[model samples]
Target: MTLSGGNARQALSRRIIDTCKAMNASGINQGKSGNVSARFGDAMLITPSGVAYDALKPMDIVLQELDGVCAPGQLLPSSEWRMHADIYRNRSEAQAIVHAHPTFCTALSCRRESIPAFHYMVAVAGGVDIRCSDYATFGTEDLSRTMITALDGRKACLLANHGMICFDGDLDRALALAIEVESLARQYHHARQGGTPVILDDEQMTDVLEKFKSYGRQPRD
Candidate 1:
């Protein structure tokens, strides 16, 4: 929805805060280590840096333009706002984004590893694998560039030595995608502990991706 008026903008801001709190409650993130944002017309509504989610008020959310500028007098935006801005600038379909340091996802990212197609569910990320961005210091344009590269043609990816990021058409789905990526990371990690996981071939993943187009929706009458 477009941020056409004060009420609408305020609503989106509250949703961003709620998503941040949910991230911690769901165990996908802890403390203020993650951020959430939603596309609001030409600007984005993002969580503020250093503010605990439990204490965030509607006005505390930062309304940042895609050019990286936030409105004057507002709290500072997330330290990683550049990455969110870059994603919104580059990915037209990203209506909402969730960036979190989920335990298993971060563990894999620390090793600079990508999640391969060890399970068909890997296709949910829009490909046969979830790529890990090259390491760069957080909050830098360089880090944003690498994330954009890793996220090419995908809805989710890992930030090397950092965390995971995902997006969808709304705040809820974006948060859900983050959780799903973490679950996938955990399963992949455990699978490796047993033995080398038998990765599905590209052809198999291709078929799975095709089916996902209609995987969960109910047919219209």
Candidate 2:
């Protein structure tokens, strides 16, 4: 049942390509500015570096060991694979990860501040506070460490001056969180333009978090 083997790898590869296409068409990503990966036992299936999402095929995905070794295939694994690998290694519940510079999420990430709990819906992100990791250059160990820290107990986080990253038990949930990050970021951006955004109180956020946990449902995030 190792993620390093046969059928699991194939399933993961197809999912990666399909997810890349879906994210691209939804305008949640551009060029090859994003990457997706899924845990298959002890290995990972990730989008190939610098490849167009639209052109991705099942076999175009790259297989990498948990230690980051890659087998013969199309292209190299993404530079951000470090971040993905770290998260998968640390978060037992995380089976899939998506990183994207979606318009709004990137806009908020560049603000030099945190994305506040402006809405209770933020609870869907595994917490009311979606942290923005300290700015780190992509593909660097520093960046990986920053992301790993920011993701502590949270399902989604923004990379300072970079983009958004979301992790979930499955690809669907991961993608949902990515989309939510973008939507919430857009809402926060517009609200800031209007005036200081209203943040949910501690008690209100707690209630939302509990209710969301109870429902066990996904809302676009």
| Best candidate, lDDT | 1
lDDT of 2 by residue, 1-221 (tens): 45645676677788888888788777889888999999877888888889888787778788789788987645888989999999988999999999998888887789855677998788878887889999989999999998888888798999999989999989988898899888888888888897887789878888988888768656785
* Model 2 root-mean-square deviation: 3.4
Residue-by-residue lDDT tens digits, candidate 1, 35-65: 9999999999999899989999999989899
Estimated TM-score for each candidate: 0.97, 0.92
Worst 10 residues of 2 by lDDT: 1-10
Q: Evaluate all candidate structures by whole-model CA lDDT and list the values in order.
A: 0.94, 0.85
Q: Ten-residue segment with the worst summed lDDT in candidate 1?
A: 1-10
* Native-referenced Cα lDDT, model 1: 0.94
Candidate 1 RMSD computed on C-alpha atoms after optimal superposition onto the true structure: 1.4
